[model samples]
Target: MLTLYMEVSLTETQQCCGDVEMLFRRWSVLGLVIPTLLIGACSSTPEKEEISEQPAAELYLESKQRMNTGNYRSAIAHLEALLSRYPFGPHADQVQLDLIYGYYAVSDNAAARAAADRFIRLNPTHKDIDYALYMRGLMSEDEDSNFFQSMFNIDRSDRDPAMVRQAFGDFERLIREYPASKYAPDAARRMIALKNRLARYEVRVAEYYYQREAYVASIGRGKYVVQYMSDTPSVERALELMVESYDKLDMPEAKQDTLAVLKLNYPDNSMVN
Candidate 1:
């Protein structure tokens, strides 16, 4: 009788084990497999919403805000986006002008000049052409602008003259085309400074050649200043160098002519004595 009872208990334990295995199979599909399938399906879905274009006014305002807060790089992004979205929008002209200023504010001299040139070409009759021209000159000046350092008498004579010449041309255009422009006065002042810089650059080059005993080359540089840089202070020094250079070259006649001009222009010049 005890053996029979033990056999019955064993049978019941086997049944319980079978039920657990079935339960596990059902739980695996419901709890794991189905959820994974659902996740995969959800993840595979394509984006259904299109990105809308922001209005040009909105973009302009955003750019303006960025500029006002001194976020120049971000402002450039918005200004560029505005142009891309609405090339001929109501604010197109103003946006182009603002773009030039934006490029300038961040010291992007090349881009600023290019934008100014584009604006002038596209909007010749623009009432604000003066402002565009002014900005072009400003950008050019800023490209070569070391005047602040020049205040300490630091020589900038070794710098490239291309930018200075461009600035001079822009200022001259502004003065000739829009003499009444609000920016004309400032442009005029900057032109004077630029001319002096060019003259000084020529004088410095002539002096360099003179020092190196390259008398012919030195005379050429000095003559350039005397001919084109007429009223500048450097012309006097330039004349002196030319005379010295001529003497070195054994051209006494050339030396006498340069000295005569120096005396005529700068009667009290120390070089004349």
Candidate 2:
């Protein structure tokens, strides 16, 4: 009986020793992590600049003030300082957001998207995620500072299509994943506008094919509108164009098909009788 009791005590001692080793390992991991995070948080910049004891939040605001004054380069300097010194600061998100805006104001779209993307990734659930997403759309559209281009550049050059698609995806994800988000309703509204614009683009391409008398090609585009662009305002116009193309091609069967679809869709039919 004594021997059995001694064996149990030895087992208990072994278990205690294992626990102590595990605890030591955990604490060592924590120690390494804390310092690494601290070092990673540091931002690189000119070493001669003064870092006031005032809060980084205050410095971030000061940077924004520089942006408002049209000192975009100066604003970037301040924002970078905030990024490096206080990566984990309360105002980090706000500072990054300002940096994106400032970069855009300076006509640096690539840099703007990068900064905006960084903020969006870091603060996916921030209250201003909607704003960030919207900014991305506007940035992609080059709608911020190229206002002078409006006079002579109605030809948008497909410059923003891919970016617009990306922005649309981001907003859609935000709405789908965060239905309760304050940004959802507004995002849904903006999504409708984006859809209309994209649909119009589809119509233009279809019209190009139609103008070229490429009946088959035009039919492909028209069907795209009917199938994928039903919600688009240009849908009826697309259907009408399809019917016209079919008639021009002497494809009576296809013409009837197009007319039937148009009638079924737009029974009130002011554009077609």
Candidate 3:
């Protein structure tokens, strides 16, 4: 009887040990899974909270506040978030316009120009369409004068005139399409300045060609300024260049006629004397 009882006790002890081992295994698996589950929960919660925290109107107002404080970088972040969240919201148009200005303030001229163009394209009849056009023109003008040039006050007259010409066209369109717009006066003023810049660029090209002894090319450039860019400050220099180029080409009649026009336009010009 004693031997049988001892054997049963040993079997019971073994069973208890097996149960504990199984429980430990279960806990081990749970230990790995719980941390992973917790990590996932923690990671996803913040993003959900962030998205839910600021709705469209709040984001728009926040962006405006940042803009008011001259915190354009922050304003841009808010504006972008607002746009992404509420593309068809009530403040979409104003948000786009603000984004353009924010990009411009930070000297992100490419982004600013793109925003302006997109706004103009999407909202052709928007009440503030003229504002977009004007901003686009300003952005195009800024493209020609980069940070380095602006900081050092470098002359951009000798640079490529493509952007300048684009800016001029933008301003011209604004003034023509919205003559009564509040922004029209400013756009007109910018157009005049851009015209002068284009004329100066043409004169610079004429000077370059003349210096290189490309008399025919110089004459063409000069004549273009005289005909297309009349009344600009560069016209005087263009006329002078044309007279010189005509003389270089041994076109005496052309030279005489150009000289006569130059004298009539600029009597006190050094070339006239």
Which model scores highest in TM-score? 3
lDDT of all the models against the reference?
A: 0.74, 0.65, 0.74
Q: What is the lDDT of candidate 2?
A: 0.65
* Candidates in order: C-alpha RMSD to true structure: 27.1, 21.3, 24.4
Q: Quick one: ranking by TM-score, best first?
A: 3, 1, 2
Model 2, runs deviating above 4 Å: 1-58, 64-74, 88-90, 105-107, 122-131, 143-160, 267-271
Candidate 1 minimal-lDDT segment of 10 residues: 1-10
Ranking by lDDT: 3, 1, 2
> Candidate 2 on 1-273: residue-level lDDT in tens?
000001001122222223233233333433343334433433323244564655776776677566555555566778788888898887776777777766665456688788878878888778766666656765665442234345556544334356556666766876877778666776678778777767777778878888898878887888887898798888988888888898888999988877888888898886456
Clashes of 2: 1
Indicate whether candidate 2 or candidate 3 has the larger TM-score.
Answer: 3
Candidate 2 has which clashing residue pairs, if any? 43-84
What TM-score would each prediction reach against the true structure? 0.72, 0.64, 0.76
Query: How far does residue 134 in candidate 2 sit from its true spot (Å)?
Result: 3.2
